[model samples]
Target: MFKKIAILHISLPIDQVYDYLEKRYNSTLYADASEQTKGYMPKIEIREATKNSFLSFYVKGHDPFTGLSVGSWKWSYTLTQEAGGMTKLKIAYEYGLFMSFISGGTVGHQAANEICETALALDALSNAQLAQ
Candidate 1:
């Protein structure tokens, strides 16, 4: 099993952050496509949502090294309002690999990759929000 957790503080209020993530989670990579067959499919499956607070989902996708779509990972995020009006976002992701042949690298490597990607995304979001 591989797992990773990340925390981010967004300057936006919890409600605003929640709304942004809600829309983002509902969005797909092929927004311009008119039909399902014509669109690029997204591997994310959102399982649950709690108004302005929490989200849980399953990501059916590939690890970078393996380059094969072979895992369904559980992911969750919790958002809380802080004293400074910032939103504290906690993210967790877990994947259990039953076969070693399918995993391209050590579990540590996979976890590190996941963490790096999550950090980069949060950084990008922070930068974008700051520019506004």
Candidate 2:
């Protein structure tokens, strides 16, 4: 099993970020016409949550780099209200990997890197929107 966690602090309010993610869940996240073109975009199935500030979903898809089936796992995102009206976005990912030539440790590293990159991208978007 490979597990990774990424946290990002967005300047936007928690409600705003929560609404943004909820909207994305309703629509296709990648918006690709084909799965091949979608590449690493995981098929996400939203799960239940007690609060609007928290979201959970399942993800199953090919490894972003190797195109190998990585099985399925639960991904949870928590948006916590923070000081200055900022939001602390925490993303946790846990998934199982099929046996392959690649080591599980390597896969975990790659997954962590991808998570960090994704967090940075999201933070950038939040900053941009806040600036506007």
Candidate 3:
């Protein structure tokens, strides 16, 4: 199993960020998949939390690379309110080898880097919006 993790301090409400990701990252976004994940439909499951103020989801789908057909994938996201009106988010993903075809080295590394950039950018956008 391969994993990637990212943390960000966002200037957005924790509930708002959580709600946005719960739909965007979870299987809900695939309701209208674009060619990339067509044949393999993923299942999204959410874990409700109150004590930790955290939300987690799991998606099961076919890995396009190893031809393994499909497997279960889990994504855990932690959100905590910081002292300075910012939300701390911790995002982690565990991937199966079946989908390694997207990137094993050059492509995968670049893709993950871009994803990290997007996360930072999203936080920036939140800051900008709040400023406005």
Candidate 4:
């Protein structure tokens, strides 16, 4: 199992930030039937949500060669309002390998790093939107 956490502070309020994330993940703007029919449909399933405080989801993964289930990426977001009315977001990510042989042992760290990088990108995007 591999895990990583990232913290970000956004200028938006906690509730707004939480809502943005919820909608972003739940959006089906890119939905397609071909992906499902091909047997490699990547998706995020909401596991738990607590108003503006916490949100958890799972990103299903599959092996490219066999098209079999390899494992899933678990992601949790915690939001809080800071003194300056900024929203503090904490992103926790974990990847557990079901078939270790297929991906070797380096996938965990790479996945964790990607998760953190995603958090950074999200922060930048949010800030850019606020600027506009």
Candidate 5:
């Protein structure tokens, strides 16, 4: 098993950040049609509270780099409210490797980078929307 985690601070409120993630994950637009056709659509769940929230999803698919159906991937997000309406977000990603030849840590790192980049893009978009 391999894991990667990232902590981010977003200018948006906690609720807004949670809502954005919930909607984004629940929407089919966020997934690939080919993956869906392969019955690999991500299954998402959300738990929310007054100041904190958790979102998680799992998807089973082939590794893009090796074209191997090694195992499933789990991604989770934890959001907490902070001072001045800011949101602190934690993104966690885990990939379970079935093949001994594959380097789990390397794959986990690459996937984590991709996940972090996506989250940062989302943050930028959210901030831009607020600025308008």
Candidate 6:
């Protein structure tokens, strides 16, 4: 099995970050992945989180390698108010692969790096949002 985790700490409030996620990545990716849930989607669900300080959801890998037969995954996040006029967003993603995919951590590290790229984009987006 291959496991990877990625996270980002944005300066925006938890609510604003959640809204950006819903408008940006949710429609194209998360919505399709979360077809099982109606009305409540990835970021929207964050509004109803048990703790107002955090938001979390999971998404599976659909890479050409894992394909359709592989298992699903969890990508959770927590947003917190920082001490020095900033906000922190923490993200975690985990995936388990088998057979040829589990041969090494090279692919897994690459996948994690890709996840980090996504997180970085989110950080940029938050910065833009804050600037506006």
Top candidate (lDDT):
4
Residue pair clashes in candidate 2? none
Deviation of model 1 at 69, angstroms: 5.9
lDDT of 1 by residue, 1-132 (tens): 666787887777788777766665455443543135433445667789998789887866554555566656677779988988788888787777652345554554665676566557566776787898
Clashes of 1: 0
C-alpha RMSD in Å of predicted model 3 compared with the true structure: 4.3
lDDT of 2: 0.69
Candidate scoring better on TM-score of 2 and 4: 4
Ranking by TM-score: 4, 5, 2, 1, 3, 6
TM-score for candidate 3, residues paired by index = 0.63
lDDT by candidate, in order shown: 0.68, 0.69, 0.64, 0.74, 0.69, 0.56
- Give the residue spans of candidate 2 off by over 4 A: 25-29, 33-42, 62-70, 97-105
Provide the global lDDT of candidate 6 against the true structure.
0.56
* Cα RMSD for candidates in order: 5.1, 3.9, 4.3, 3.5, 4.2, 6.5
Cα error, residue 44 of model 5, in Å, equals 6.0
- Local error of candidate 6 at residue 39 (angstroms): 26
TM-scores, each model vs. reference: 0.67, 0.69, 0.63, 0.75, 0.69, 0.57
When summed lDDT is taken over every stretch of 10 residues in candidate 5, the lowest stretch is: 42-51
lDDT of 4 by residue, 8-99 (tens): 88877788778877777544543554365554447778899999999988876677787776677787899988987788888887876553
Lowest summed-lDDT stretch of 10 residues in model 2? 98-107
lDDT of 3 by residue, 31-87 (tens): 656335455555567865443367666655555656453555566778898876678
